[model samples]
Target: MPAVNSQPRRARSGNRRDEAARVAVLHAADDLLVEHGFGALTVEAIARRAGVAKQTIYRWWPSKVEILLDTLIEDTAKRLPVPTELPTASGIRAYLRDFADFLAADPAGKCLLTLLAEAQHDPGTAASFHERYLEPRRIAEIEMLTRATEAGEVSPVLGPEATMDALLGPIVYCALTGVAVPRDLVDTLAENILRPRA
Candidate 1:
């Protein structure tokens, strides 16, 4: 039998430690952002809350915004289910309606709203949010819209980018402004955007 390498064992231990610390930092960031808002979130604060050194966070993320972005991704992944099996129109309406309900129910909503407001002034932060968070959701929407367009459920003239903007932009605006769009409104919005042309 071949002897086991000690280095590989040590590397595995290190990987586990790294994974644990990373999860701690992300959860700590989520809690801090939810409890105190973005203004109070900092690498130092996250490190303190996670009980990891600040250098550990900097080694992984470039900025506080990056950490917040990760938390947003985590939060959304756990809560949002963008189903591909349903008809595209139904999927989008159901997903956005569930999203609105999540916003009404989860503190992550407040954290996301605050992060977005901050992004308006910070180009780097905004770019990170766009790439890490918004782009994936946008990609999913585009795919859904493509399916809808192929099925003739949506107007052939209605482009994915424009249709999504027309459909979802108002919901985002309402979220930012503390107005809530109910599921029926979400259905109406999706119907309007996906309505077939003559």
Candidate 2:
């Protein structure tokens, strides 16, 4: 691993406080990303916004994109609920509907679409994003779908992974296109892809 000496090491007594500062920086970055979009955000801007040294931000994250990706994952995508109990047929529909609403309501949603587009032009960003964020979300959604299948809420013939893609693809597509996603479409996606067979 590479050394991280960009910032002076905090005393052991202050490690917890340092972590709090780091979180503050992340929060500032998240706000800047939502406010200005990625094109205008920078380490200096984030440091100023967070009231931290530039070196502190750099010590933790190598690039602005990395920080933005971290912020997005921490704030948005990971928070999406995959029910612990097997979701009922209606519960599953409600979950998807709620998810759509959440996505449409935040700049984090726009940030994700921006990241996806950036990934197309920047392979390193794409790889990091897939590993750090998207892959985990995919796995979690699949796991939730599996629970639904076991509960007889979803057809056994449709695998969880495929169902997840089929269900989420439209939302992603709309997000990318800046289109409004109707709640009705979200429910239809749940019924068409997740409903159990007769």
Candidate 3:
């Protein structure tokens, strides 16, 4: 399957005024999320910060959750882009290291963790998160893994879905538990995942 566009939907008219407002709102939401966190962020505060009316924000998004969702999408795309230039094993390792660092320090990481927590209570949020962010990334990774398998770089014992769960589950578990990710874990995962099954 082709990679999905994970960006939030926006007006397609290409009008400069609408574009400017959208940029301002996204930036404001990002700044507020980093400064005050999700628990403290508010739509009113975002409007005030962006110098736009609350109606302006509501025009594009239903609530602050949607705004944060958009910000998270943008940030993750820029922060954890898939590595296309390296060999598959190397690329996976590099991606894991980047993910570890993102969980440790990036504001986007905090946003994602917050969203995960919130999704537990909000079914709408859960569905949107899965459809808009997680699924697309999974599809992209699976595509990469398929290429590696075809090229004979790695012989995965499990199918693509299970293999991905095995590779990414540990890091995500560490993030959820607030445990520090071990420095060598990336290499260990790469070795195990890329090794041919006996």
Candidate 4:
């Protein structure tokens, strides 16, 4: 007969405490980045803000950049959900809406912009970001675009990469240049990307 519980039981209380501390540290890091920007973020500050020891943070993440990147990943995963089954223009619209909402509502948006800037000027940071965070999501998005193109949801001529660039460029541009994206830009982007070319 098979055992009712196949896995070994662990110390639930210890694990919960660890998770709570970890979450506090991540949230504190995110809040600091948003409130003070990247330059002002530090492990000591995160510890104080999170009400944890500095060593606790360093135990999990080696550096401040790693903590910030991890926070960004966690925030994106929570906020900007991409549909995994089928990629439709409508699904893209939904994803875009969620992304826009995150930018408007969450501090992670500031962290994202800061990482993008670091990627531009700092190679080590860029390497870590691409290897750990950006590239995997990028590949997934491109695959999503491929499915969208195949389903006649977007223009095949531009293919996945170009279409993705077009759709993403405006959001980044508006963010970086201080121009506001229209309230309906989510719908506008979905329509423009999916509409037939002349």
Candidate 5:
């Protein structure tokens, strides 16, 4: 007789129940963060709101910060997707507008601010936030700029890093400072940074 395998089965990636629990946990974390702020956000609270065991939350995410990071990534991807079909300048403008709106909107905007604040004190959080969240978006924006340069739609005078800073800095500053992002900021940024080939 063959020896019985005594190890417990690991959850499959495509398991429906696992996916549902994941989504529930993410949603619960976002809702709780918005409702009670990060100070009150805990693994226990997330588990309760998600209707899952505390151990389940721990099984997937080690801590509340990880859960919030996941929530932020999902929300940013959904709300501020990069424009693919438009011309580079137009795409940048559209993206900037979306970004501004995202910073102003509830839940996601709040989530971003919360993470940024949390990152200030904890080196581990800061590193993970940069590596996991900010770097991907930065790379995507740089690719957009590269395409525009290759197409001769815009001058390549500004380096990719400078261009991103110019386009994103003001709106993010406004968001952090609690000031309203100007209505014409996107247009101004696009026109200036993505100046037409002359």
Candidate 6:
């Protein structure tokens, strides 16, 4: 008889602990990434911050950029309360205000701004940033735009993609440049694109 492989037994035990460890590592990596810009960050630094072996971080994330990107997304999700219900213009404005406050309050925002700048220099990084970070937020904004459209709050003229871009562009542009993105701007952005009822 062929010998039975013990891999399954090892996998079951390894996976749970591995998942926990990865989460811990991410928590640590996020803090460090915020404290030090990506240019100054290293896998060893993340491991040291997280109190895990560097090998563990390597096992989970291939590169520092990948790790920082993932950490930023998770951190942003936790900090920002993205409304799941259909969004009103006021609701959208509120979220944007809260998001802007979150950025202004934390060093993470600067780190993210820097990462975005770096992405311009590195096409591969830009691709990953778009796919992993920007796409999901765009989808969520599109859903909100659709809701506004349905409620007759937004004009039915602009297509969804254009609507989303118009709504999001100013906030993102201001944030990237480290300027204040006012809540009023979100309203102005939506109104310009959506032309909501007077």
TM-score versus the correct structure, for each prediction? 0.82, 0.84, 0.84, 0.83, 0.86, 0.80
Kindly list the per-residue Cα lDDT of model 2 for residues 94-167, writing each as its tens digit.
76776676668766666677788899999999999999888987777777777777777777346777777788
Worst 10 residues of 6 by lDDT: 8-17
Query: Model 4: per-residue lDDT, tens digit, 154-183?
Result: 674466777777777787777766666778
By lDDT, is 3 or 6 better? 3
In terms of TM-score, the best-performing candidate is 5
Model 2, which residues run further than 4 Å from truth? 1-17, 77-79, 196-198
In terms of lDDT, which candidate is strongest? 5
lDDT, candidate 1, at 117 = 90
Query: What TM-score does candidate 1 get on C-alpha atoms?
Result: 0.82
Query: For candidate 6, what is the total of clashing residue pairs?
Result: 0
Of 1 and 3, the candidate ahead on TM-score is 3
Residues forming the 10-long window of minimal summed lDDT in candidate 3 = 82-91
The number of clashing residue pairs in each candidate reads: 0, 0, 0, 0, 0, 0
Full-model lDDT, candidate 5: 0.84
How many Å off is the CA of 104 in candidate 1?
A: 3.0
Model 5: per-residue Cα lDDT over 64-109, one tens digit each: 8889899999988887776555356666777788888888886888
lDDT of 2: 0.77
- How big is the positional error of residue 65 in model 4, measured in Å on the Cα after superposition? 0.9
Better of 1 and 4 by TM-score: 4
Cα-based lDDT for every prediction: 0.76, 0.77, 0.82, 0.79, 0.84, 0.73
lDDT for residue 122 in candidate 5, whole number 0-100? 91
Candidate 5 deviant stretches above 4 angstroms: 1-17
Better of 1 and 2 by lDDT: 2
Compute the lDDT for candidate 1.
0.76
RMSD of each: 3.9, 7.1, 10.1, 5.9, 4.3, 4.4
Report the C-alpha lDDT of model 1 over 1-198, residue by residue, as the tens digit.
998877744434432448788889988988887788777778899999999998788878888888777777888888875567635555666777877776666766766777779889988878878888888978887887788677766663467788878776777788887787764787677666677433
